[model samples]
Target: MLMSAAHAQVSLQDRRPVLKGIETVDDPRRIPRKPAAKKSKITVLRGGRVFDAVSAAARSATVVIEDNHIRAILPASSTDWPTEARVIDVTGETVMPGLIDMHVHLTYPDSDANIDEQGSAVDGAMRGTRNLRWLIESGFTSVRDLNGVGEAPYVLAQWSADNAIPAPRVFTAGHIITGTGGHATERPLTPTHGHDYAIEVNGADAWRGAVRQVFKDGASVIKIASHFAPDEVEAAVDEAHRLGLKVTCDCEGIYTEMAVKAGIDMIEHPLPRTDATITLMAKNHTASVPTLQVYQNVIDRNGGFYGSTSRRFAMTSQDDFDVFKKMKAAGIAMGVGTDTIGDANKMIPNVYIAELKWFVKGGYSLADTLKAATIVNARLLDMDDKIGSLEAGKLADILVVRGNPDQSLDDLQKVDLVIKDGIFYVENGQLVTPRHVAQPLLKPSPPETTK
Candidate 1:
């Protein structure tokens, strides 16, 4: 479920129901590993001013891609070009690491609706497949879905690999863990619904058990929602770390202090936080995903709770904005995310660009903002070693834009090409790979019957 950081609440003495049948096993099949395909093509993307995320500035260079990894980054004047490799000249463009969005929801496509509950599995799958395509075409090569409904994350990963879906590399936290009656609670609060979208536990022991279940269910990361007790948060973080998974929490309110104290690895929208809390987060080396775009979008399009509160926040003071600035100044690692849920037209790729603009408007340098979207986000996902930058030995996830984004952030919207895992997925702002279509098992009968 989507939540705004503005509605964060907590009850220190909240009691949890003692339920039975909380069972899980360390299933070996949890984390799927795709067998490496037969060696891929060796294609060298050349003659572009490369912006390796680690570099101080963009430089004229030639990137040599072999198989699925970057072989080397050579000076633009190098003469030793391999004859067997296919070289594509990307002159006059900025070649940088493919973008990464830190927070997203693949299961919920429409913000105005809950597709997970309203539609069939096939319906959700089709929407997710299409959304993935839209993101990749818009220059995002990878994203982390913060929450998903039941086995959807694993299923999506399998489809991308087993069926060769042309989509961004996806990482997911299978389900959000929240306290009983917390932000993500289902209305009826039934057991089936509890397991479907969230793990609503009570005590520290229950939190640990839920975290174990999440790992056993194939989540690469664990997410905890707002309103959790300090011990519960600590136990969740401890169990996740012990199990080799990172933990991120929804710090929509005062939970920021609790999350930081619990040694949480990342905080989603660690806003409405005091400078002391921001400083504390930096001291603890906790990363953050400030999904400011969601608030702005809500304010612009709807006057719902998120919209009204966001408006008030915007009008009241630059408090949150100043907090974000303090976060960056305090050396808190910030990653970019557009928590946009809705139709693809205005929500997707465009929302990501809007977030970038907000970062610049928030006083972040263009280079720092781009880094937050790329390498910084990659690091937040523990994928920096493979996919973050345009460096040798890294996976070749590249984006070529028409103009230098360093000079003007708007140039990012003009993506000329997108390359993921050494494959050219988009060229000249057009999709090039074969589309992945979800074939439903059951076809709709008549319109009336289907309804």
Candidate 2:
């Protein structure tokens, strides 16, 4: 009378699977305009050990990318290849989700070189083109730019989307909103503090205006300067949500407490938060991105060195180290971020490992720290469905590190390869870009050739 689940079938089946008794048309002319041109040819990556961040053990697996997304994760034994398919042999490496850092000042460089004088129409794009490879070489495949210094983050992000740059997928908040004389408004040099154009809103009304302004200018998230007042912070979050953007804050103590109450989406800091503050943050689903690396790099100016840039940027009593463990114990969400600027003199490939090392030193288990940087950040980005793990149908945002991150967080410093958006940016810890200088090339080059 009725077909059982196994017996049910479709008529005139093609290569594609059936959906609800309808089969995808095999006729080229009949296929839809949107998907026909971009149909993927399978690319199989074989002989790789997997360190799927969510999984407990490293499995030998075959990863297949179809178009821009991962199509399948096959077992070690499955070698069935489609004709004309490309195969990548990763004989000895570990594959895991690409790293995610929530707080990055994309506009900053280690030195004071004028990148402005050096480039074409795409200043940020060019800088990103150079730096993206550096990030990938250090095993990062995604970053959340906390601030856009020179209108560069957007170009880099768009170029990455245009498949022009071999960098990690970037989600950026165009600029940070700060009160007229807020911490974000303060600058290191000059007798008179300059207004941070990044965010120069005055009050609740101005905060409300920035929500729409940031989105129109191409921000996926809205950030508000909150150390000034809790009610002021709440107003911005409320306004940003109506326009459809997640709200993040850069503040400490009561600023964070009020933001949690206001329903801020995430907090960016080393979390100068207390145990009570951590509990409230957890209850409110507020995530924290401890840009500890940046803050830790805070050199003491009063100690006869350069001014502590981190201390200058920080607000309130909570910006200390103890807050991290208390927050971790209280079960607050954490994401990876390195506010540190890097280049040749720094001797660091990327700031991510620096952030991870602190988590290990600060008493988080290695696995938890990895989860914070990878899975947790993905979840915060609303990209968990696409990149957090080696899941099918997700984009192949992955990295292979030198040692097992599961064994120790310190091993994270040794990078192996970085693959983002199904493109290889690095292999064997070397940037795939042609020989170029990381120092002088932080400006736009000819888009046609550099790409």
Candidate 3:
């Protein structure tokens, strides 16, 4: 009888002879492959002074991260970390929630006076990509882009998710909605060019239609430019609210009162207003994003950025500052925003530090200043649950700095490490990973010598 092919493939003398009911296996490649080992998802950050943001004091703690959320915040003296966890010793560092910028124009990257005119949509996208990476390494893990040109903001949002670009989590308002010829058009050289930053529509119906269009265009927030009719303002706010989107308005003078009365959720760069208007804004629970850094820049340039209006500039004009102080007294929420336009080189993270110092000068304590940048801003974005505080169960968007920001506002700029979604992006003041495009190191310029 002829032997089976399996028995014929093997040496008959080398193996036991195959019986009629037995089978022989000689193929080496047919051996079973063992399963690959699973990578560990647990990480432990030990020996850090954690700033919980809710309290005025820092405490020694160990933050245990499981996947993307913080699993536990144990006492620093505890030694209960899982043996499989990767531990990062942040001894002597100040660990706090990552910073949040309430307002920005990610697509606008020019320090020149004609920033709005210098870039096309494609150019803005490229520059925006670079800026986003810089923001993340600088400790800003999330941003609210109030006005972004074309599809740049939406594209950046997707890129950030795909890790095509290392950008902060973005909540974008695609374009500013304005009256036919308002603040959005005042600077752009031509009416057609104005569409780069804003869309012009007239009448209440037009305002409602514009709000719907922007929502369709993927805007999470609705930003109405200054100088719209009262009915238009009311219509925009009502429509945006109905659509479950909050309304933020760039308001000045009488329009500020109108916007507040119309139930607008936030006001940007609020113009100096009457006491009645300020009180009304506080009463209405409307928040403010004071882009004091840009205002101070205008003042520093001798008002050159605003032409004749530059001379009139002050860091929150005395009267306006007084009103804001009063509003603060009334429990109105205020957050910091740079609003720096032009280049990534010009609008570096230091601008944010400068803004914090101005807040300090304006009588905000270090704790309140930090709160404004983190918890308060997070609340403004309606993300207080998921971020803003170094609490258990929150996404691990955190910063480890060299010193206590509560001691010196300047320490906020000392970003020794940045972590987003439980992933380390910056360590030892350097970017260890670049998601898509590699970012070049940007060093600060030396102080100018006096003549």
Report every candidate's CA lDDT.
0.73, 0.65, 0.74
Candidate 3 lDDT (Cα, whole model)?
0.74
| Top-lDDT candidate index | 3
lDDT of 3 at 363: 82
* Per-residue C-alpha lDDT of model 3 across residues 390-446, encoded as one tens digit per residue: 888777888899898878878877889888877787889888774466566598666
Evaluation by lDDT, superior candidate among 2 and 3? 3
TM-scores for every candidate against the unseen true structure = 0.82, 0.78, 0.82
What TM-score quantifies how close candidate 2 is to the native fold? 0.78
Locate the minimum summed-lDDT window of 10 residues in model 1. 11-20
TM-score of 3: 0.82
Ordered list by lDDT, greatest first: 3, 1, 2
Residue 293 in candidate 2 has what lDDT? 61
Model 2 spans > 4 angstroms off = 1-36, 111-126, 187-197, 299-319, 341-350, 408-414, 433-451
Clashing pairs in 2: 124-152, 272-318
